[model samples]
Each structure stands twice: as C-alpha cells, then as structure tokens.
Target: MKLHISFKISAVVLVLFAITVGMLVDVPRLDILNESIRNLFYHVTSWFAMVFLFIASFVYSIRYLNSGNEQHDLLAKIFVQVGMVFGAAGLVTGMLWAKYTWGAYWVPDPKLNGAAIALLAYLAYMILRNSLTDSLTRAKISAVYNIFAFVMMVIFVFILPRMTDSLHPGNGGNPAFSGYDLDNTMRFVFYPATIGWILLGLWISELRFRVDSLSQKMNDDLDIKSDRLDSIPRLDEE
Candidate 1:
C-alpha cells in the first residue's frame, strides 16, 4: 500500500498525541454523563470529521455534474466511502457512551434513530453504484445520488432531531455539550482531535484514490493490448 505525502505524516503524529492527551487529561464529571464526559473528545469529534468528509463528497459530486470530470466523480465516491467509516465510529462511540450514561446501547431517541437512517442512506449508495456497469452512467447517477444523500443526512442528523423531544443532548431543548459541558480545557484536546481525524480521513482517501487510478490504468492497458492483438490477421481469418 502506497502512502501519499499530500496529507503529511506529522498530522498523524499530532493526532495521536492529541488522543493521548485526551485520554490522560481530567474532565468534568457532570450530571448523568459522569466520567464518560471524556467521550466528547472522540464521539463528538468523529461526527465532526464525518460531516466534513460528507461535505467534501457533496461538493465533488456537484463538480462532477457541472464539469463531467471523472476525477471529481471518483473523489465524490472516495469521500463517501471514508465518511461512512467515521460516521459508524461516531455511532458506535455514542452507543458506548449511552451505555454508560443512559444505561442502554440502543435507544428510541429521534437523534439516535435519525443518525442510523442517515448511514443507511449512504450505504445504499455503494450498492446502487456497483449495480451499474457503464462508467459514464455510473458516474452521473452516483453524482446525483450523492447530492441527495447529503441532503438526507442533514435532515436526519440535524433537522429531525431538533423537531421532537428527545433524551439526547442538543435535542428537545436540551443544551449541547458546547453550551454547558465543553470548557476551554476540553477544547484544547477536542479541537486538535477533530482536525487530526479530518486529516487522517483525507490521507486515507488519497491513498485509496491512487490505488483505484492505478488499477483503472492497468485495466485500460490490458483492454488496448487485447484489441491490438485481435486486429492482427490470424491464419484462419486470412
């Protein structure tokens, strides 16, 4: 696997350092959340990173539609793929934090359910995209779907959660972690953690795109050689 220099390795090291500090640093033991407040560094930051990744994907999709550039289409797909992983991580960490705070890994809150549905929408993209065989058709259709998926994600993750009363913080009139929980102290770790994860996501996406590009080139070369060989006169055909 080739590591791309575009993301830079120092960012990864900084992220690791930030994570270590987040783990060792003392956090406020607030009501219900207790020691689990440390999860703010990870759970919240992962969602932040996921949102950034999805936003990039949405932008690339739009570019693909306007310019008809296959690179934009590829970027749109790669960002979605990486965003989904971070989204899943956020969900899992939230579940664990919920287990500690709410006493259940699964809950009936609108926020939680909406997040799950949003992820499902993106997962459908992979399935729908692969079902198409033509590259042009696949790119156009997937680009349009990416825009739809981003809208769906915003509605499910942000809009719907606030529409109803819920146990989750930042929902049902409850103040968000930043409003009352996160202080300047936590921000030191939290901000860096978010930046680190975003950089890491971009790094991974770059490597994946490079691998895909090389694979596509190899396939195209093979197709050209096959065509050239077929054009030569065979004894039977002659």
Candidate 2:
C-alpha cells in the first residue's frame, strides 16, 4: 500500500507540537514528582504507541492466518519489531521516572514486572522466527504465537496492572491521567503526544516492511538466476 504524503507531514507536525507544548506548558509542583511529571508526555506516550503497534500486529497476524498472504505476515512482524523498540524505550523512561519519584530505578512493582515479562515474551517470538528455516512454517507458527502473546500482553499490561497495587498511576486507587491528574493544558499535549508517537511507530514499520520486501525480491531474483545457470549444459559435456 502506498503511504500518503499528508500522513508523513502530519506525523512530523504533531511530534513538533507535542515537544513544544510538553516543554513550554507549566506543571503543578507535586510532592515527589515535581518536574519529573513532565515525563507523562513522553514515557506514558511510548507505551500507548507500543500498545497501538501491538494491536496492529495482532490484527495482521489474524489476517495472515486467514489469507495465508506473505505481505500480511511481513506487516505483522514489522509491527511487532517496532512495538518492541517502543516497549524498550518505555521501560527505560519509566525507570528514569521511577528513580526520581519512587527513589529507586528498579522497584519491585507489579506493572514494571508485567511490562518486563511481556517484552521478554515478544523477544522469544523473535527468536522463534529466526530458528525456523521454512518461510511458510515460520509465518504460520509465528502468527499463532503472536496472537497468543498479544492477548497475554494485554492482560499483563492492562488488566493485571489495574487489579494490583502499582507505583504508577491508574492502579491501586491512584488517580489516572484523567480529570485533575491531567489538567486541560496537559491533556492537550498528552493526547497529541500519544498520537504522534503512534504515527512515528507506524512510519518506522512501513520503512522496515519496504526494506524486507525489497530484500526478498532480490533474493528471489538471485535464486532464479542461479537455477538458470545450473540448468545450462556444461561446455565439457557438450
């Protein structure tokens, strides 16, 4: 599918707007959080972007299973790869935010543990893909695994976090990014940041898909050339 020029322009504009507002907007001085609350525009948005990418990956995995189309499989894999990158970024930023707020970089928080486990599960999916040699087998098995993992990840990151106590907001009776926690000024920047990050993730995934497609085509062409060369009669035999 062709990517629209407007989409790229919009992604760029939104990202710039997010940065401008994130930095310029004044935030209330809370007890422990203080200025670190500014990370809400970045760290939280990264996970939101990761979740969006993973959902796309899950949908494409289902499409691949139904259609048996390699393109769908390629898209699913690219989305997961990009999602993993965002997940890692979220983890790092979360740790940094934690250090300032919770007085430790790596606390034994349920949400943090869940995010770590979920990321490891996806990493295992990547390893599984590399271990398989046959393309069809790899795609089919990976699609099944991807669907399962996405569901588990949702439970880990979304459901489980809410059920238990978490240093992070929106869990354990803590206020979420709604109402007073996210004021009118912060909401304007936070929502845009979430969308901007998701768009950036999609753009990155598209570029990876194109590169993979080109590499596959080049390999196919080389294989065809090799077959033709092999079929040619040997000069000595002739």
Candidate 3:
C-alpha cells in the first residue's frame, strides 16, 4: 500500500500544473459552452479517473476469484469505493456545466441518465457486500457481483450514452470539443488533468487499502487470542 515518493511528488506536480493551465490559460469560447468550457477539465477528467480505477477493480475482482487472494479482494473493494467517489464528482461537475449550457441542472439526456445508472449499479455492489456476513462468502460473492457491476457500468456510461443522442460532447452524434477548439489548447490541459486525476484516485485507494488491511490484521489477532482464552479451562471447571 505504500506508494513511492516519486509517485507522490509526480501526482502533486501534475495536478497543480493542470490546475494552473485550466484556470489561467485562455480557451476558445464556443456558442454554448462559452466560459463554462473550463468545466471540461474537471468533469471529463473525473470520468477518466473513474474508468481507470474501475478497470483496476475489475481486474482485481477477477484475480480474487481465480486466485482466492484476500489482498486481491481487498484491492478490488477499495478501488471500486474510490472509483465511485470520482464518479460522484463527475456527476456534480457535469450537472454544473449543464446548468450553464443546457439551461437546466438535470436533463433527460441519455448521457446524464446513463452516468447516474452506472453509479447506482456500483452502489448495489456495496449493499450486496454489506448484506453477507461470512468473510469468505462475502469476498467470493461480491467478487462475482463486481464483474457484473463493471459490465453494467461500461454499458451505461460508455455504450448506451453513445448509442442514443446525447448533449455530451463526443457522444451520440454530438461534435466533440476538439472540433470547436480550433487551436487545440485544451488538449494540453485535458490530457494532464486526466492523468493527474487517475493518479490521485490510486493514491486515495492505496491509503484506504492500508487502513483496511491493518484493521483486518488486528481483528484477526484479537480473535486468535479470544479463541486461545476460551480453550483454557477455568478454575471452576477444574
């Protein structure tokens, strides 16, 4: 769970640089986006991070099922948790952008609804895990459910949105921002922002994994001690 110092420094620097560019650099104003174009950095980048985190979660879930490694299950769980957080951030930022550009905060747009449904699918994974009592059973069943959740997310967030007309850029016949920004200045900011956010998500998940692993270890030690004490005969019994 310990991250290298280099990665820590790199994440901090990339995010700060991206923020500086996003805030200070001037972008070509489109008809609808106008000043709200700045949100592209935050909103789109958050979705990118979510995808990266969830991809990791999916891989770990499969690994857990195949290898039966507790570490893999723990990683899958933590990654999904952090991925949802970024998904929520994407939703909030997208809503703000919609308020300014689309004339409403929440629309019946396919992309918007798809994103919401994707998050709900992940929420179901959390609920399913909590409902199971046995540790091994919870890990195995949740790992299977995690695969389904990831697929549902892909369909809702990526596939369905594009299959239908969407107000979102680069989806469902909508011209992407790249077409509007003739100078392509946003590319410089957008790419770095996406990478920064992905790294930031990993950093957060790593910390959570560390805390959970330690807690599990402590709980296991206590259980062992209690079992040993119970096995010892009391004075009254003797």
Per-residue lDDT tens digits for candidate 1, residues 1-238, read: 2345655575687589677998898787678877787888889988998999999999999999999999889889999999999999999999999999889999899999988988999999999899999999999999999899889889888998899999997889987777754557888788888888898888888878877776676667668777676554333431
Indicate the residue-level lDDT of 165 in model 1: 94
lDDT of 2 at 141: 100
Model 2 pairs whose backbones collide: none
Which segments of candidate 3 are over 4 A away from where they belong? 227-238
What does candidate 3's lDDT look like per residue over 95-193, in tens digits?
A: 998889888999898888888888888899999989998989999999999998888878877888888778888998888777877787889899988
The 10 consecutive residues of candidate 3 with the worst lDDT sum are 229-238
Give per-model TM-scores. 0.90, 0.92, 0.92
lDDT of 2 by residue, 68-158 (tens): 9999999999999999999999999999988888889998888999999999999999999999999999999999999999999889888
Q: List candidate 1 stretches off by more than 4 Å.
A: 1-7, 227-238
Among all windows of ten consecutive residues in candidate 2, which has the lowest summed lDDT?
Answer: 229-238
* lDDT (0 to 1) per candidate: 0.86, 0.88, 0.87
Error of 2 at 160 (Å): 1.6
